[model samples]
Target: MAQWLAAQPKTIVVQPTTLCPMDCTYCYLLERHLKQEMTPQVASAVADGIGPSWEPVEVVWHGGEPLAVGLTRFVELLQPFESLRQARRVRHKVQTGGGRPITDAWCDVFEQYEIGVGVSIDGPRELNHHRVDRGGRPMFDRTIAGIETLKRRCIPFTVLAVVSQDGTGQAAQVLDFMRDLGTSWVGFNIEAKEGANSDGQTPSIDHARQFWRDTFEWCRRNNDVTVREVSNLLGFLGLTQERRDADSQHDPIPTIAWNGDVVLLSPELLGVRSVTYDDFVAGNVLEDDLSAIVQRSDELLYVQEFTNALETCKQTCEFFSFCQGAHAGDRFFEHGTFAVTETDHCRNSVQAPVLALAELLQAKGSR
Candidate 1:
């Protein structure tokens, strides 16, 4: 238990609020409309809970929409980490949908705190039609305007684009759009069937393979922009000669919700409920010590099952070393159990890209 608790994650994700302005079609946030904000007391509790560490800790501010808390309230939320930041390195990050109103005041906070911003957008206007508001109005222009503001303020940000079936064929166009937006780095997230919205079919593995291949070619042509998925796949395959240590399946990444409830692993698991696992809450940080909660988390039935399933994958699956098994939230949502192995998510996200890139590299080598 001591060895298990020692492997703490470097990043901790905090959900400051659960109030999003837009209602995307495939959003997994079940309680997005709850309109709850994390109190400064809870924020301070969470910060103190983390305590001191040798390495720099990153607090990722994520939510239904983190910006929904407004600039003034958001600063109050960050106040708890000030002591830690002064003592040692404590990096701040915020992940937002980027469709909300972006004011100079918000930019001032970003610049002052040096927060790493990650904005969610699905590419061109046509591709982003699914990420609309409650009135079904397209948010492409609004999101772009917010991104443009970030650019004007000289605050560097990364773009997170969800690749749906509609936009899979337009990889080049998507690359061009992000490039024109002056985005230095872009991450691609497949439209996953998780949480409340499980209507859409997972993209076929073949289609995903082709999409990644095409996107890889585009990235090769434009050396200025970095595509995260391609780079990660290449690194995993040893094609880029940048191999790193495989992520530990048991490492605890504490994701604290707005109410101070701590969820290990995926932050998406915060609001989701399961019949067997209940709310998947290890314990409330406000009540229990963070380290104690993380240590006790290993005793959770679902966590035990999740760890067992990962061990099985490591023993059986060929790609185990690369992915270290699929994410716990993905496995639970797609398979309805953490003890299951191999999901549509694994096929498209993990296997397809590696196979596609391997084939491409093999052909080039043969030539």
Candidate 2:
């Protein structure tokens, strides 16, 4: 627990605004309708809270749709980090829905800041129908147009696709679609029940396991576009086999809400309200130092319970070394508590991929 408190967050997720153009069915942001934007004061407080770090820190501009704040207002929000950026101590990244609103000015800002952009497009039209506009219209064409704009401007960006049950079976198609869009990197996020969307359906453990296996095989053959999940699993498994102390180090990741409220660990825990813990909010950047907030959160009962669960996992679970107890938000949402280990999320996301990759290696050895 001391090490956890001492660990400085490498990334700070900043939600600029709750407003969004599209209404993805499985979105975790329950308050997406609210037009609330993070105040400049709040932004300044976040900048001050983070202060100086020895290593480069990433400020991820995330939201219902970060671009929904518009290009001009977005630049204004980034003003507080300019000094840090100039010093090469901090960098900016944005996770956007890649709707119809992207403009040349946005690309200029991206180039100026060297923002690592990640566009959220769930493959082609058939797969992306779930991520629709407010009027329930598919945004595939508009999203692709935004991707084209980024490409034309010579901006390298990553694609993040949310895999639903409907789209999980089409691994080859998803791979081809992403490659055709000219993205060098693709990350898949499985739909989970969280925040306001408790009814969201996750593919069955078996289905998800098969999907990952198929996806990994396809990516292995293609070798051009990087599949984030498969690559990460392979890296962790391949590297950590010789290192015993890998699971002991836990880095805190702070998520700053529109109002300056900070939540440690999973960013998905920020906006979510729970009967047991209220809202997992450690503290506010305006009122407390980041170090103080993290220390205080260590005293929280839920945090303690989550820590205990992770310790148990370290002792009990075979994949604990690679996964490091997995994401707390998923545990709370799926199993109603963090004291438990191995949810369906774990099976599909971590365990299944690991098993699949190992089997592939075994087959190669036999051959």
Candidate 3:
């Protein structure tokens, strides 16, 4: 169990830069405006840390904006992991805002590397008021234009929409909107109070639960599309006692920042610092060894605090068997400490969705 707990993540999130073209209202990044980019040296060091002995990993290209990093520079960062890709030891995905024009050049690169793409858009144009530019102007059309380009080039993409207060009861509207947009894959992320996003509203618990229920129904009725959250919810509901124990163990999701600094558990911990935990940095790929840092993750102060909080969760949170102290960043960003449990994320992403699925199941059984 100790050995399994100490293993690295199957998915590693790598930030290429801190420059985003659009500033979504609920973005958690503190350094999203800076132009600092990851050096090729840092990329090489990260690749070395993964090594050939490790299992295959999904390398997620994330940033203030991944596509905003420019094609040449983004390719340079990915170059280090080329061998892994060739060996079928690595897969890639990039989460982009699609605020800037996504041209054939980007599509060519996506095809060349087989990078899975995810675009962030909040429902229809009217609901997209929350996604704005540097000048605080809504650019919903601009994002749609990029999606259009992807479609023209026959590049498939997954849409990630934030389910904030404005989107509470409008799940069917959002799903219908996405259906017209021609997306076959969609994901909903509940906006929460975290990082630089202090004002993110938690939808009334009932609204949130209903949102999930409706979303699940939509996907079930419409055979062409699937929702990521629903998939996870279904998977969790099917877990056996032994399976839950094994899957409950936290994977060391190592997120490497532009300069190679590593943060364990959550990407939201990138720029946050606490007086108690100081910076939640586990180590730096440039200075410290990534594999060693992850292996000894328990030594970090915030991790120790999280361990204690998770123990508390077993006693307090009824969803502990499924959640297992799932979101470390949510706990810290919401309460300003990891020695706590039951965050806004816990309710919106975990409990509410779980209950919603159960309710749907009950109704189906009655039928």
Candidate 4:
């Protein structure tokens, strides 16, 4: 079997805790309510696993509401990685729900660390109804208040909006709302079936295509906030096909869960398990070196299958430039394995955006 792409981690998605305050419909974490916070020892062990690598690493303190770990523990969690930060070996980022409180204290720490913040907010109140509290109450106002706090403190942030059926129709409106909310960049994630959040309702490819087209048109008119999808495709369009293919190398994006368990490739695959592949833990940080896990990532049974699938995508798919192999989680969740490609996710998020961007750019050039 062909080996997976050369494995060096570009991003380490650290799940500091599984304790999220708000429950979002699109979220896939099975144990979001569990208070399985990462220990300082585990965090240190993770840092130690890297062993003073000079290559810049992005340490993303990812989901299950990283802020819900409480301010003190949250600060304590960063203690181990201080050396990496000081050495400029790693840059820190946090993707928060923004459903919890974002006080001056949070902003203070963010400023001190110079962390890049990305808030999970789906535009305004109407677009944000999917993310609610445990009691099923809408968290739009609360989330907005937290974002407002960040703005007041002069802390810059990016917004990640999940495009639901409603969002697919109102792309311009959603983009406008997020821009008005003062986000530096707006990233739109398509609602997909993954983990425990599958309710069978997902946006159709036709509708999703429309959303991308509208987003591209809106971006042409208003060049204020960068629409991540549009920007990505635009960059890809600028690149020669040879360069694009060469740049499609899939790095092992290791997601270290609260308990030191590592899931590679797809961060959304952390809590998910497959009978064919077993639990997708490449290795545990406490038991194995991070490099060792990454080295063996290409040899993993599922990864070997992914190698085949990605080969197919590279050969057969027209829009492989946009998403590489799309996402393994989407393949496993939607079609039950990563041994094949052409998932609904690829069509909606990858192909649609690429097609829309190409057509729009061509029209602009002609004009």
Candidate 5:
């Protein structure tokens, strides 16, 4: 086998570009960024710096709309990383809002390279009411058109549906929409305040509990297509022996913003404060050593108290083994600090274990 990229980043999330055309009401990055673009040189530096050194690392292009970075830019950014795939296995993933069709060359990269994409479209029209562009128009039709393009071209893709408060009562309908999309896997994220989503309109605890129960039951019925949010738990229970606890407060995995600033371990760190300054400590990968930059930034005394508190949550909570702590940005936005236990995350994440046990007991009683 060829040598792996050296950084040991099992998953590397890069903001390929920070230019997004959508102006959704609940965008998490809205508070944190305007429209900074990631230069090809900076992207090349990031790829060279953190391409995994051992195991196959997954590369995820996250953005205001990664597609906004354009096909030429994407090609330039991906060239170095692609060379690694030429030698060994390097998985590439992109999280996009699906507002634009990828150019033909980009499609070639998707096919020629081992790239998987996750498109953001909440659900059907009613469920997607909040996913609109700046003109305050519904984007479901255009988003669906983009999805169809991927399907027609046989591009591997997944859907990430944000479950809105209004859509909580219709989990089945929303799920059905995803199934119709013809993807093998899908993710359902509860709308939380982050990025531009500052209205504090996450689902009520009661509703979230019911939604997860129903969603889980739906999965039990299907037995096929995978669900990202829940399967992370099932993977822990039935497969991996690694520490599966969400509350476990280990150092966060690394995430790279458009400017090449590295946010260790927390995906939420990208835009939780100033659009440019929040969660940022810099090393221009194009000019500096990525590892040295990480080492120095890791030493900064920003969230020590919060990290200690998270350790307590992991060690003490009943569902610690199953719950991953909310990203620091999520905790900060929802609870104001990384160390503070996120009551809502606790409630939502705790429901599955409680419900699973109840179902087991009911089955035993019936037997």
Candidate 6:
């Protein structure tokens, strides 16, 4: 058990800049860029805080649009961390919106330093309307061009698509677009109903549920490519035979924002407001000791509350153990508590999937 724990390395997320050019409706970070550039001193401090101990650290550059910092300044920020990566202490990654053009020089930096890259795009032309520029013009062409550049250069990347009401009805079309893009893997993230655009345009929970069902069935029928949303579901379906103990190395998945704040579990948690903390950031890795902050974060208090809710759920819901409670941000946004489950997630992410699977089983039995 101890050996298993030792094998996993800690992950560090570094946000070099948060200046974003695009103005997506659902982007919570749109209001977060009051100030969004990191100094050399802060970047160096981040490098020193993580230190040489955490054997396999992953530094993820996430931002309003990570590449908005420009390729030159980005290189300056990465130079210090790149040296550490070369020494076998850390891994690197960058997440971008792909709304901007990519340069050969940028690709060279990515090829030289990171293990993988992730881009945000809904799908082909028609499905990506909501992610437009400030002038209300569709930027899908530019995004597609950026993706083509990556594919042309053989740079390994993943596409993250937000499944919305429109997307739900057009899962097949979205999948077709992905297949054409030659996307090796795709993550179909559900649009959160509580953030920037939630007030006027949140998708119905029923629509979300249908979308998950349709998307999952699509993945099962077309098994040639990797679909991350279905992969997670399959794990829940007991389809995978592999089993291991809990002592396995559990690296802290860090999501560092442009201002140096660290969020746990997922990067999506950043800017997600909580009732108690009102802010999701546990600490700034550059200014605070990473280990100490992780230990003392107010974020954990919310996690504990959520865990307590799960315990209560197990007593009531038959599928409690198999379910993922609402994402912390969603819970806080909808219910005003991290401990409670949002009706949307319960209906969409959990209840809907379970019921759909049950119906399929019953129909098969009757036949």
Position 201, candidate 3: lDDT: 78
Local accuracy of candidate 3 as per-residue lDDT tens digits, 1-367: 3532547678789999988888888888888889899989999999888955677988988888988788898899889889989899999999988756789999999999999999999898888888999899998888899999999999999899999887878898999988888888888888888888977777877889989888888878887777887877678768786887653567778999999999988888887777888888888999877788788888887888887888888878778877777788888888888888888888988888889989999999999
Instruction: Give me the runs in candidate 3 sitting further than 4 Å from their true place.
Output: 1-6, 239-247, 363-367
Give the alpha carbon lDDT tens digit for every residue of 26-141 in model 5: 77775223668777777777767753444666778887788887887877778877777777656788888865666556677778776787889887898887877878888888
Evaluated against the true structure, the overall lDDT of model 1 is: 0.82
Error of 6 at 298 (Å): 5.9
- What's the C-alpha lDDT at position 11 in model 2? 83
Candidate numbers, best lDDT first, in rank order: 3, 4, 1, 2, 5, 6
Give me the runs in candidate 2 sitting further than 4 Å from their true place. 4-6, 365-367
- What TM-score would candidate 2 get against the native? 0.95
lDDT (10s digit) by residue, model 2, range 1-367:
7643336767889999988878888888878888889988889888877745436788999987899887778888899989988988889999999653667899999999889999999887888877888899988888878888888999999989988888778888999988988989998887778776679888887777777878988988898899988888767656745574565555567889899898877787867788888888888988988656765777676677778888888889998877877777788888778789888788888887888777778988999
**Residue 341 of model 1, lDDT score:** 80
Which structure is stronger by TM-score: 1 or 4? 4
Cα lDDT tens digits for candidate 1, 1-367:
3332335568889999988888999888988888999999889888878755536888899988999988888999999888887766678999989747777889998888878999999888888877888788888888888888888988898989888888778889999988998888999887778887778567888888888888878987888789987888766666433443444445567899999999887788889888899989999989987767876777888878888787788778888777777677888888888898898788888888788778788989999
CA RMSD for every model? Answer: 2.2, 1.7, 1.9, 1.8, 4.4, 3.9
Better model by TM-score: candidate 2 vs candidate 6:
2
Candidate 5: Cα lDDT at 178:
80
Q: Which ten residues in a row have the lowest lDDT in candidate 1?
A: 240-249
Clashes (candidate 3): 0
Candidate 1 has what TM-score? 0.94
- Model 4 lDDT per residue over 160-179, tens place: 88888877989988888878
**TM-score, prediction 3:** 0.94
Which has the better TM-score: candidate 1, or candidate 2?
2
Residue 356 alpha-carbon offset, candidate 3, angstroms: 1.8
